[model samples]
Target: MEEKYFTPEEKKEMLALSRQLLAHTREIQERDDFKRIRHIISDGIKQNHYRRDRYGINPTIHNLNTAMLLCDKISPDRNMIIAILLFNLCKTEFIPTEELVKEWGDDIAKLIRGLLKVSTLYSKQAAVESDNFRKLLLTFAEDIRVIIIMIVDRLALMRTINHHPNEKMVHDVAYESNYLYAPLAHRLGLYAIKSELEDLSLKYTNRKTYTDIAHKLNETKVKRDQYIAEFIKPIREKLDATGLKYEIKGRTKSIYSIWNKLKKQKNDIDHIYDLFAIRIIIDTTTEKEKSDCWLAYSVITDMYQPNPSRMKDWLSIPKSNGYESLHITVYGPGDRWVEVQIRTKRMDLIAEKGLAAHWKYKGIKSEGDLDTWMNNVRDILEAAETGPMELMKNMKMDIYDKEVFVFTPKGDLYKLPLGASLLDFAFHIHSKLGMTCTGGKVNGKNQKLNYKLKSGDTVEILTSTAQAPKLDWLAFVVTSKARNKIRQTVHEMNNRSATLGKELLERRFKNRKIELNESSLMKVIKKLGYKTVTDFYDAIADESLDINNVITEYEGLDKKIPDAAEIRSAEEFQLMTAADDDSTSSDVLVIGDDIKGINYRLSKCCNPIYGDDVFGFISAEGVIKIHRHDCPNATNIREKYPYRLITTRWSGKLGQQFGATLRIVGNDDLGIVTSITSIINKERDTSLRSISIDSNDGIFQGFLVVGVNDTVALNNLIKKLKTVKGVKDVQRSK
Candidate 1:
């Protein structure tokens, strides 16, 4: 035995908790190999210097000790121990994977990879925990040991959380442990480990609730122990009289569990059942274990009035995760209901350690059934899901699904979650069958589409060529397969509608002598207040896009292309509205240095030049607009406008010129503004026309402008600018 692996101080720290593991390992493991592995692990930890720190590795030792404590009176392999000690190492990249592979062989390396894969994915998978968990489980699907190690690894880390300083880490770990890890453990049949996780998680997540329930359990410990003794006395004597070797122990429910009981019972902690159950562990061989479990159950029920409704015989057919026990609730001492679980020692081992014990040691169900389950799970995972959250939701629905096995009329069995209806069943058979499904017959009786299937029912689906799925099927269908098929059908229908709509829109565009691209149509659709391009298309397909209305909208947008007058109107209208104002008249043609300090300028609207008749309008917004006499908004200003109009003109030769941008789009080329600049610069005393070029792939848009005599000169400049080589078009910028 590798007793020397633990020093005296180390023994004092962890010996008591690990004694059971040590004993089990000593019994099952090859002596020299266990000795060498333990020595190597200890030496490796001591010799190597870790260059990283996050969660302390000191707690890792505590976690391993805690894992050993929960791993029950059975051995975990070198992979489990090596992986646990090194799981935190994976996050920091402190150890190279190839080095571990060289030192520890492929199994240990693979196990470590699985653990670290989860550690790396932990943060990224929060939004998709259920699916991520499924992926994680599948990552280690080939090696059952990897999952067992992870469950234990989590157990270790969770036990050491309180020692850490990060409250947020503690809370997050506790939540994931409770909501995801603990349930996973339960599903894996590690009830003992599951209980601990739940209790510890609640301890951190809801300390007050955990504390109150724990305190209450402690207060009634003696009485609870006494009651368990009295309750099990009769069963113990009965088993002994029959000469069946068995060890009976009373089990107290965990705090979180008791809290759940309290909530379920709608009563105080004191009113809840203190001694949750009595476990009868029988000594037997694997061959006779099932019979012995039943015999034990028979003995217990003979002595006490059994609750027929509470009998759960998983012994005949163990859980998918290899959990087997026969439980019965009977009225015990003082008329209190006590639950009793009867199982052979072999079953007890499996129930305690989960699939690890079975897969490594027992080989009870080494292949067929578990493979089928995992294959089904993989199929479910591989199916297409649309939104990000849907993957997790559907994965959770599968992971937490309570399966019910039903038979086809031909005697082949199919598994579906409980509460799955006929529609889901038909879809489960085949998508074509589901799409054409008219109804079904359950066990020789006709059933509706919504009829909930039960176990052992032989379902026969009836299909018709004319039948098709309705949108309302989404309301009743449960499985993702049916939902997916239905959604695909709806999408196909939408595609057909879109095709019709596109054709109709194209015809309308052709009739109007308009070129309508998708981009242009989308712009027009949005301008007409349609929510989506699809909505616009659907309206067209349904004849909702009336020809007159479509023409009106398209023409409105086409007319909005800013010529000089429309540009003037849009600029003035888009500005802040004028308030009440009174101002003195000024000459149309005079320049004075004294007027430079005033808050007024030639408006961008009319751009009144030196020779044009101009008028100044005072604005309460602390600005003034100088407009031409024939400005677009002149009639509105003269007749009905509120702001005071100050008649004025460019009285003198004002050489000052403001800037404007002309947007010129073209294919990428060098010196695109050569001819455009020649025209503007050829004029006498021409102001600088600055150009800024933006190039994307083979396309370029240039913004350039110069001093203009009036709108006519700007117009001529734009026309001549468009005639330049490589220049596709020209437009004025706002």
Candidate 2:
């Protein structure tokens, strides 16, 4: 071991924590495994395999803390503890997987592999809010223990983050804990870990509010304890007479929960009822667990008036995470409502330890529901073109929602999130069924495809050979599978149309005995204001652009051709004011004040307004064309003609107007177009040159071509138009 890497006290603390962790797995403590693990770590230290993380926290201490948390709270097995110990060594490649497998076994090696993959993902600095990152996390975590270990690792980090040297690291870790890890823990039924994570997150992120709540809880501890004791007194007497072997304890709500209620309900802590809950854990056999819990519920409700709406019977159908409990809110002493939870020892274990406890009670209860959910995860991860973040939002919604159990006509049950539409269910059963579904008969009643399903409804789907998915189906389906499939189908349809359109145009040229010139066709396409050949062809297939018009433009290209010196790319550019902040010497073009000698103009493909990042592309004709850095053609220009590119920046202000187009969509309310025109007319130095409107299904989509002095004027017009009545969206045409 490297002695200089740690203080004497630090080394002693790590040694003690390591011993405590091994002790949880008694076989490892008794055998030579402990010393072997220690030797591996010493070797890792010699090779510099372990070091402080980016937050400047000791790796050894952190891993030990995480392992101890797993042991003390989760009741994990020997392999889980060993994996946590050697994870860092394996991650750094100091210990190869072959050696790990030969010594530690395959389970240990597999856990470390999952951890390493997740570690690599983190090194990319992906945001916690990124849905793709979250999906990939689950994909990498094939073993449930990998997720459990990660959750505990995050908890360990949160507990010691006060010692972190970087404030930004502290804040980011806290935010990730709150938004990402906390919800995951909740989903897994690790309520204790979830609550602690949320509370610690509040402590670091909002210290003032955390301190206020902490002080209030501390100040009222005495009175709160007395009230709980008084409330439990009579309930204890009733259960004791019944000769039930049970333990009852009072649990106060975490600081974060209190703060959330205060903020949401707009009430102080004093007004928050159910601030504490009384839990009753019974020692009963699995066969009698349900009956025993019911007996306790009867005894408690017999003594006090029970609120019917406040009762939750998870005992009948346990939660998706296998959490089983009976909760009842009763008017306790002083008429204050107090919540009581009744559960067996087995149920309590699963509730507190999540999947770890579920592993122990594997066959005692069916995990088919959980298995179904895991399969849904795989379905969502299928190859699709949708953005990962969008997919993640849909997945997160499913994770946080309560399941609605519906049935097929044959009595096969399917679980969906709350508010799941009929289409969502059809997709959940099978993708093909969902695609062809027009509507369904729910419990023998006809319902539309958009009908929201409820529990216990037997659904029989109705389909037709002529029925096809519509673009509007994306608006109703909530599942990512349905949404992704719809998008893919729509994209395929457009591609087919584009292909057909291309064939039709080519056949027309063949029939007319007119030779098609590729370059001339390109010029015609550009002149038609189409960015790509696909869009041009699709327009022809849809009959939006007349085929004869395209041929006429192609024939006229020769007559309208400019001289070589005057020819420039069809792209637009802008001149920024000298006052713009983006101005830099390196970005400025080397064109001097003798500007008349240069026959250059802004390219028409990308409209680069004033203050936009601009670059100069020297055309083959020696005409320098200014283009926006983000132009659609910029990538091709940069990749294929790197030598022709020159760094350019907007210089002196040119007191002239530039043309821009805006696309707007909103309700087809009375005079909505007039309202939009009025708003644009009010902006100074902004003029609307032309407008075209199309309306369908009470919705209107329009395009407006306007001339503005600069991007500033264009943006101002957009903002003012956004404020118009019935305007849902307004943005510059890309």
Q: Give the C-alpha lDDT of model 2.
A: 0.72
lDDT of each: 0.61, 0.72
Q: Can you list the residue pairs that collide in candidate 1?
A: 588-649, 588-650, 588-651, 589-650, 589-651, 589-652, 590-651, 590-652
lDDT of 1 at 421: 92
The local lDDT score (0 to 100) that residue 320 gets in candidate 2 is 64
List the candidate 2 regions with Cα displacement exceeding 4 Å: 29-31, 123-125, 130-135, 234-249, 278-734
For all predicted structures, in order, the TM-scores are: 0.41, 0.46
- Per-residue error at 160 for model 2, in Å? 1.8
Question: In model 2, how large is the Cα lDDT of residue 421?
Answer: 93
> Residues 1-734, candidate 2, lDDT per residue (tens digit)?
57987889888989798778766667434378778887888878887898776666888888889989986766635677788889988888888889999987776787888788777655445456643344446655656667778999999999998746787888988999987787666555566888899999999889999999999999999999999999899989999999899999998989998898789779888777668889999999999999999999999999989999989898999876677889899988787888898999998866645432432232223234443554343333333345211243224323323556566666555667778899989888888888778799997999999999875567889874324466788888888888898788667766765775686578657744579999999999999999999989877755566575687577666664445455232111111222222112232243433233233446544556666778776543234667778765577668756765666666555565666667788887756766877887788777777675555677777667677778888887888888988889997764
